[model samples]
Target: MMDYVWFIRWFGPSDIYSTQLGELAHRVVKKLYGLGNKKRDPRQIGRRLRRVEWAKRAFDRRGIHTKRRRQQAVANKDDSITTHYHIGKSNKKRLDLKTYTHSRDPAAKGFWTKLQDHILGRLMQHEFDGDTHETFTDDDRKHIRIKDRKLVELQTLRVNYTTYDIRRDQDTINPRNHADVMMLSPEDEPGAHPYWYARVLRIFRVQVISTHPLASTVLSGPQEMEILWVRWLGVEPGYHSGFQRGRLPKVGFVDEADPFAFGFLAPAHIIRGCHLMPSFSDGRTAGLLQTSEPTAARKTDEIDDWQFFYVGIFVDRDMFMRYFPGGGVGHTANQGFFQSTPDNAENEPRGEESGDEEDELESDSEMHQTTMPPSQAQAEQPFAIDSDESVDGESSHDSDESFDSDPEGDDDLNETDVDDWQWDDGYGSA
Candidate 1:
């Protein structure tokens, strides 16, 4: 049937009457009339109809309900932290702007007062002369003035607007120094060997202006915060060291770490701590920091080769010495300035693959066995049986053997064909 598939396709079924032409014609007629709901196959039509109905139902649905949305809490009179400020949505919503809730900071009282006067003066272009004051009662005039002042303040300040002091401590290890190295956090790449190295570019402490989950935990002083900005050195196509083989780079690393060499940012918590390495002149030995130390202020070389210490993960002194016998795993000048440790010894290949392996040997032996002449197979097993033997094993005997001496006596045996002989169940002699 499979061999004749082309014939079946070329010359279809002989009987056209047996085909479902009638059903197809009926469907075509129904489609022309736009008669959807009728005697239809539910398996075929039900799903399509359901999808259409679903789309129709979803067409006019509204966006997220106000209750379901997470609303930000703004500063209020009831807020306990008077020192720290916050912003909340105001009652009046105009255009797309929500008026800023009034700040009760004691420090801003003078500023707010001056701002109010500046705003009111612009509105009251005309002087309120005695003639204007005489028309309204003193209480009414005062109330109007107060309301206008409040309105101006609200209009001037925007909701969600904030400001904070960026405190800089020159005492701490300055990240901008470029000498600072940090331990990378495991959370950066979860479910992996997360300890990595990065060079710090900047560090600063500031007051957090926005609400976030980590705000409370991260804030050290009153509204003050700290974070470390870093530039990550890539691990993919990573530099191998004396100890370890490189890992297949995770997609996250490849995607996030710009292969073309660009900078990326990570928070301070993601940085575990600072790591330091000793500088050496030879770029190999890890003796005292003195061997590399400037001894009599020697002239600097044109192509400076005195770069030995790098910002990276810290291994114990003993382990480092064991792995790197020369005290440092120096990089060839062409490669990047980083090194990697091997994963495991077992997974590393003992030697490169070649044609003379055990598998190749087995394959060669098989080919030799297969190509040998039939005469060799006969020589290997000359007495091999080709057919089944009878229960009495008579067929297995050599044909040249002599069996003319009959067990039964010659007088007792009658003339009969040996092939057609019929004997009693028990031997008559026995």
Candidate 2:
């Protein structure tokens, strides 16, 4: 056999050949033991040996004489190639670092403050004059005039008034000459001309006692005041049929009823002492709360006639105070005429009694006409519906509780006696 001394020397246990020495040991042991031989040509084996030697020499030149160093050199080359390939393929670039920036101007904070001041200054000077800040009153002729004028503006539009008979207790489409009906008008109509328009604010059946003097009172008046149901018609284009009239321009005939006829049917008594004029607007017009004397005086007569004919409609303020007594007017902040009474007490009437004690007592007695007798009051009081005997029997059954005890003698025992009992008998026997 040819001497293979260099091959064995090269695969020896020195640091330079440690890995190859392990592989050679495996092959030699397998062959000697008759396990098998690795099938590799001499040329291929020489190529693998050359690669290992080159790695070992490179490691040694760097003062890395250990087996670990040689392996590390080979691994390092692989890592370097991977990192270079990734860098060459990618298009990533480093970004510039940034610092935060802030504004130091004082004017930014003051912008809104300046705007508010300007607006408030203009509002104070142009609108709320000193006298304008004073409280308004229903009794104030100026205020009433303004209210009437505004009402006239609202009433210029066409509206409908339907009559409901209290006597019949049902609605009648075609009202009889003297029959009553409910009426309605809108509070505000969108996109309409800003002028006096006809609106059926209320409807109540008032007896036509005399058309000549035009004198009449609310059918159920003073004591049992009737509620005049009002329907506010908004400003919209529409017509009023037979017994109906269009706008004021369409009122061609003498005493010809407008579509909304309550304004023409009103009797004098209801509106005699009351002020009727345009006092306020829906704020759609400039100077909404302003009062005009001439316009109000003229409209007073017109509205008075219209209101008298239209089932004697009253303004909200007048109606509230008249019917509701202490009910507050305009805004709830305004004090009401009536004060609340305690549960057990009666609400004393507000005005002074016109007659003597007997008359006052009679008035008080009249107020109780709708009240029931004391016997009825007692009967209405709540009490148990069942008999006293049945209640007593149920209570007795609930009170009984005496039949629940164990009969066994073993139920009670001293703690020491129980503890002395044997528990390990089965285990000990086993």
Candidate 3:
């Protein structure tokens, strides 16, 4: 009946009518009947129904949107001053900073030190209050406060972002499972790659309390701070990759000495979670960090990172849109980049939508227009914030979290329909 969707305009819109709709009412009425004495139960049911309606009306009048139904977390591009995100309805667990066994919790490895450095970063480094990358002096670090050490681990990160088509949408991100994340590249010339990529090692919330004179305004007392401990991956130094090349962006673990190899990040800095499939042919090696001194960032038993991974842009329409920028990945007034420069315009083919890509966009766009999934709607508002910052590990975040593979709802979005990032005989000039 999907083909009949065009008739919706002609016949007027209608909900799916079925016997189950009518039948479900009886289940509720029976439930109410069972709760009271059978005598005059019909009257009781009617009274209960009226009470429910009255309560709903009261809620509407007071604008009391319950948290359970407050699902429109995707703010529109025009309204969003800060990134909007949610964690769905999963329960969160907090852990103490120590196992009392000489800080041997591989997961929480470097938790205390990294977190302490993070406090210093927040106080000195982060771009808070219109400041750029500045750090506290040795004297300043002495005055910086660090109190609570408990870490709150979240299960999911529902990142609400604006679709390229100027509509709001979101992706559910989980560190244990859906761990890959993407953000706008800090690079100037993005002809090769336009976004930064990272594999989230863990998601945490820290309650920061500072008594330092420098942190009086920002850390007045105590505040809940959300951060992601991520291992940063870099685009292959000279690998020419993009859909324009009929290939995905080739990325790999950066050198251990790179400041961004690992870091803590403020949640708002992320654009959205991404799909990154391993470049199996390239193989994995423990040498990225070291096999001898296994990093706590990896699983307890593992000491390797995928030598390389391919950006799976074709995983979904939104993801495809993000890479195929001209496909409309939330660029208003041609601002957020999706076009090549005049030098590479012909080589890159600006705004050139291949027939197949165009068809996919049209089909997805049509589906979008026809089906109004209740989960998504024209959001009434987007997120706003005064200040946000990236706590790029500048130092390795290799110091934290016990690695437990929580494989809940692992997404098998990989489709063999797309070609893999093929093997290249050699590398280009560095």
TM-score for each model: 0.22, 0.16, 0.54
Q: Model 2: how far is 139 from its true place, Å?
A: 34
Q: If the candidates were sorted by their lDDT against the true structure, best first, what order would they fall in?
A: 3, 1, 2
Error of 3 at 421 (Å): 32
Residue-wise lDDT of candidate 1 within 294-329, one digit each (tens)? 211112322222223333333333223222323222
- Model 2 spans with C-alpha error above 4 angstroms: 1-323, 326-333, 340-353, 357-375, 378-430
- In candidate 3, what are the lDDT values of residues 1-430, reduced to their tens digit? 2213443554444335434455656666765677678889889988866765576567668866443222322223223534576432222466665631255433344444455556666654465221123454556545543345566666666677776445676676766567788876655553545677777776676667665675653535676567787777888865665545566778887666554456666667688888888899999986667544445457666667789998887875557655554445344222334565345434653235665786796775455334433333343112111111227613222333121111101012211122221112111111
For residue 217, what is the lDDT in candidate 2?
22
Which candidate number would show the highest lDDT if scored against the true structure?
A: 3
Model 3 global lDDT (CA atoms, 0 to 1): 0.56
Candidate 1 TM-score to native: 0.22
Error of 2 at 330 (Å): 11
